[model samples]
Target: MGNVIKMDVYRMLRSRSTYYILIGLSFFLVFLINNSHESLLDSQKGLPVPKAIVGIGFDGNLLSDQMSLLQFFKVFARSQSFILILAIFSVLFINHEEASGFTKNIAGQVQKRGWLLFSKFICQGLFIVLAFLVGLVTVLAAGEMSYDEIVLGNIGQLLKEVGLQFIFHLAFAGILLLIITLIRQAIVSLLVSVLLCFGAFAFLYHAIDRWIQQGLGIPDFTMNNYTITGIISQVSIDSAKGQLIRAVIVALIYGMLTVGLSVTIKNRRDL
Candidate 1:
């Protein structure tokens, strides 16, 4: 297991594409964080902090009562967060070697296919964490500069909320990476992952199931008077715990199954 993980890390770092992907993601995230504002932080004169932030729409409606670091993190995470970049990262995780035919050579050298698959998935997760931490630090820095202060009434609470959002979002990203491992192509996988992510948020059950409940799965936080919507749309995180649990479970299943299937197929192939 250690060898597998080490090999994955080594291979990824040795590859130019991997470094390029991380660098590109960093730049893309910084762009999102920077452009998410109506004007640069340096341009703000003396307007109310909430109003100044709300005007940018990077976080949420500052005029509302549900404003806080937790809510702000959730909103900012979706709008300007690098979850998309992370997801794209995962989808492209294995492509560099595959494109260069390194994966095929390794498959020929290895008798244990499971180790190869495990290493790839583990590597995917490692890269995800690496890339995410970079974005997290960037966001933290940007948050410091953007906000007048970051008072932590309960430091534990802030970490808990931020941590859960990070987990949920990361798991979502991993799912796409696993999907890519199955597809073994970069562009197709990336587009599919992005489209699914964007479409999931825009999609609602209004036109389908009329019996949707607030806590069925995700929390909805929208102010619209819609008769029904997923809990995710409501903005309350009553279901986040459950969502996190389920998302992790499903992502793991997808990751393992996809890796397993890919190995089986590759092993059976003539080349």
Candidate 2:
């Protein structure tokens, strides 16, 4: 497993796409910071600041003041752009081994082929952590340079949000990994992942919820409440403790189920 992980790390580092994605993220942060600064300036001048420019908080409130570093982090966390980028990256990275027939060689040597897939997941987690830290540092430096006052917010809350977001992202990545494992086609997996990130299947979930409410007469029941995408859409810094707990539980369940299914398929099927 250690050797497999090391090889994955080496491959990931050598890939030019990895650096390109991170560089793109840095540019995105710069754009957001510049827009935020402009919005603040316009507000000070008594000009009408666009609602879109003001942005919405996790609590659904319009941000009237200059955004703090923590607030910027929250914006990045909630943005579909980050998830979309990860989806594309996962498709490319996971498909590389299969496309090159590298997996066949490794699978024959390993007693437990499932560990090979698990090792890739470990590397996925590491990449996510690196991306999160890179985003944090970018926001911190850029926000400080752009704003007159940079509020750091509560340290505990920041850490909590980061941890929860990481789990949510990892679970989402697991779903993409499963899709890639099953389909083994990069283009199809990429399309499905993009749709998932954009909530393209939301109508299906909503229709099911409606049917359950009408047939079973369960008025308070909602499938979104238990879904990763739904939970992430609603999670905010001000979310109640109970809500956070539920989000964590849902993330864990989805992550474990997807990874387990992928490993089972890997072990039973010839790679």
Candidate 3:
């Protein structure tokens, strides 16, 4: 398992796409920081009413507040949608290997299919950690440079928020990995995973949520369970503890189920 993980990490680091993504994210942070300031100050120079409306609508809290780490980390949460980076990396790491016949070659040598797949999961987790580190450093450095004095919020709460978001990414990657492994096709799997994560799931979840809300007069069910939008919202810090707990439980369940499915398919299928 260690050997498998090492090889995967080596390959991932060598891939041009990985560097491209990191470079792209760096530039994205620059853009986000440059334009993230509040327009309320600008309103003082012009029409206050219109600027206030614009400021309210602008989703640039990470740049505007500049103090809280949660706000800083919200850049990826805001811009990456629910699964953009995770989907791309999982597809490249898992589906691309299958498409190129690398997975089959490795599977022939590995004794346990589950262990092999779990190693891939570990590799995915490593990538997530690397991404989180990059985002954290970028935000903190940018905050220090942009704000006069960084006013941090609750440290414990910030850690919890970041940890939950990391878990969400891992869970989402597991789901994508299962789909790619089952389909065993690169382009098709990539498109399907992206659409499912980026839009399809959200759309279906929202429809169900709205129906439940209308019929049952429920206020918080959708916001608390498997709802990508709710999880990514900047205001999630203010959500009830129960809601966050439910979201984490749902995410873990989804991740475990998908991993089990992948192992089952690997064991039963001829691949």
TM-score of each: 0.64, 0.87, 0.78
User: lDDT ranking from best to worst?
Assistant: 2, 3, 1
Q: Sort all candidates by TM-score, best to worst.
A: 2, 3, 1
Q: Which structure is stronger by TM-score: 2 or 3?
A: 2
lDDT of each: 0.53, 0.77, 0.66
Q: 24-81, model 1: which lDDT tens digit per residue? A: 7656555554443334332354344332232223433421222245544454454523
Pairs of residues at least 3 apart in sequence or in different chains that clash in candidate 3: none
lDDT of 3 by residue, 64-165 (tens): 434567666665554543366667777777767766888778886777766677877887887777777777677666756655555566878778767777
Mark the regions of model 2 whose C-alpha exceeds 4 Å error after superposition. Answer: 33-64, 144-148
lDDT: the better of candidates 2 and 3: 2
lDDT of predicted model 2: 0.77
RMSD of each: 6.9, 3.3, 4.4
lDDT of 3 at 271: 65
lDDT of 1: 0.53
- Per-residue lDDT of 172-264 in model 2, one digit per residue for the tens? 878877988899899999998888877788799999999999999999878878877677667765789888888888889889999999999
| Model 3 CA deviation exceeding 4 Å by range | 38-65, 78-82, 143-156, 210-220, 234-238
Residue 152 CA displacement from its true place in model 3, Å: 5.9
- RMSD of model 2, in Å? 3.3
